[model samples]
Structure formats: structure tokens, C-alpha cells
Target: MDRLHRQVGAVGLAAAAVLPGLSAQVDQHAAEVRDLLGVRGRRPTLTALASYTDGLLDGATGRGWQPPQHDLVGWAGADGVAVRLLALCALVTSAVA
Candidate 1:
């Protein structure tokens, strides 16, 4: 869990920095992550991760991305649950990139 957490945080930071062009995709990925968090089970986590991966793939192959609006450090620190989901987002972005 610790390893996964750290990896997610690190990748999330990178994703937030470099994947802004994929903002629309990121939005869906973020939503999925948030929704998954509402449930309790490993399956939900896996599903959210899968959705994020799909979003990243779509983002990469779709079109141009915009610049990210928030600073990585500041954004992640803003809210607890959000931060976690974003961390997972970061991981997915990095993995796909």
C-alpha cells in the first residue's frame, strides 16, 4: 500500500505537470477516481485505475492538450480525497506516457 501510494503520488505530480493537453481526458479520469473512492473494495480501485489508463490512452491519441491550471504541490494539498484521486491520476498518466 505504501509503495502504491508513493508511486501514485509521484506519477500524479508528473501527470498534472505534463498531461494538461489531455485535460478533458483527465477530467473523466478524475471523476472516475472520485466515484471509485465512494465505494469499498479492491475492484473499485482497479476499475478506477483502468478508467484512468483508458483516459490516458485516449488523451495521448486524441488531440492537443491545454496547460494545467493548478500547481502540482498546491493542488494536491488542497483536499484529502481529491489529492488521493489525483495521485492515482498521476500514476496513470505516467504509465501511459
Candidate 2:
């Protein structure tokens, strides 16, 4: 019984440690969705926004499985527009996350 109690306590402690990270993930995703929809200042319609954001992120991840490579000039063109775009996305994702 003592061992079982110790295991339960450990499990509870582990959950307490992890819960905040899970909450932050949710909040960050919400912020990203808001930014994506150009609705940062306006009130969000939660139901629709959640679904739209999920679809958008899912499609984005599905399309790009690999990270962008470091190349001075590539498919993004000689101007490096593609590289810049990827950088912007990473910045936003980190900021929101």
C-alpha cells in the first residue's frame, strides 16, 4: 500500500509539471490562429476559428515535412523570397509558441 501511494503521488506530481506546458501550447496555437486570420484586435469566433486553424495547420504540416535548407539561391529564386517566407513563418511560430 505504501508503494502504491508513492506511485500515485509521483504520477500526480508529474501531471502537475506537464499541465502548464499543455496549456501554453493551446494558448500559443490560439494566438497563431488569431494572427493568421488577421483578427488580432477583433474578437474571435471560437468555434469557427478553432476548426479553421486546425485545418490550416494540418494542411501546412502535411505539405512541408522538411525544414527549409540553407541555400543562398534556390527554388525561392535568386532574390530569396522563399527563404524569407520560411524565416517569417518560423519567427511567427516561435513568437506565438
Candidate 3:
């Protein structure tokens, strides 16, 4: 495999590894957010996290998101809550770094 392929494989593996944990965190966050906002089941937390994390990994490795979603904020948004948390982590890390 090429360098890019290896890196991609690694990122995919890392994302997969943390997916469950990230989903759990996102679920917690979503629950709180929803409760605060007085909404129910409003966010597709797990899927969004995975999608966002994938997007971040791609961005960090100099690859753009492929087949980007038409709507990433709402119901038709990205998949996997782990991905979403990755993006959030990136944003926070960048802000603090």
C-alpha cells in the first residue's frame, strides 16, 4: 500500500476504535443539549460523530471529504457521532493550541 493508503487505513482504524466511546459521549452531550433545549431525539448523535470524525481525519491528512453531504447540520447530515466529536475536538484543540 502507498503512504496515503496506509495513513488512510490508520485513520480509519483509529476512528473505528473510538467510535463506540465517541458515540457514547455524543449521546450524553446530545441528551443534555436536547433536554436544555426541550427537544427529543433531535440529533442523530452517533452518525454525526462518525461523519465529523472522518471529515477531520481526512482534513488533517490533506484529503478533502468525498461525496460530501448535501446537508450536514440536520436530519440528512453526516453519519457516525464519533466523526462529529473528532471535528469538535479539532475545533477546540485548535482554539486552545
Winner by TM-score: 2
Candidate 1 wrong stretches, greater than 4 Å: 36-97
lDDT of 2 by residue, 1-97 (tens): 2232232223322332345643344345556656876778554454544455346446655877333342322222211222223323333434445
Better of 2 and 3 by TM-score: 2
lDDT of 1: 0.49
For this target, which candidate reaches the highest lDDT against the unseen true structure? Answer: 1
TM-score of each: 0.29, 0.33, 0.27
**lDDT value for candidate 3?**
0.41
Worst 10 residues of 2 by lDDT: 73-82
Tens-digit lDDT string for candidate 1 (1-97):
3343353445555655555533344455555665755643223455557665456546643765322344454444333343444546554544455
Cα shift from native, residue 14, model 1 (Å): 2.1
The collision pairs in model 1 are: 11-90, 12-90, 21-65, 21-66
RMSD of 3: 14.5
Residue pairs in steric clash, candidate 2? none
lDDT per residue as tens, model 3, 1-97: 2232233323433453456654454446445544644445544343443454455557754644442222222212334433443334433322344
Candidate 2 regions with alpha-carbon error over 4 angstroms: 1-18, 46-54, 57-97
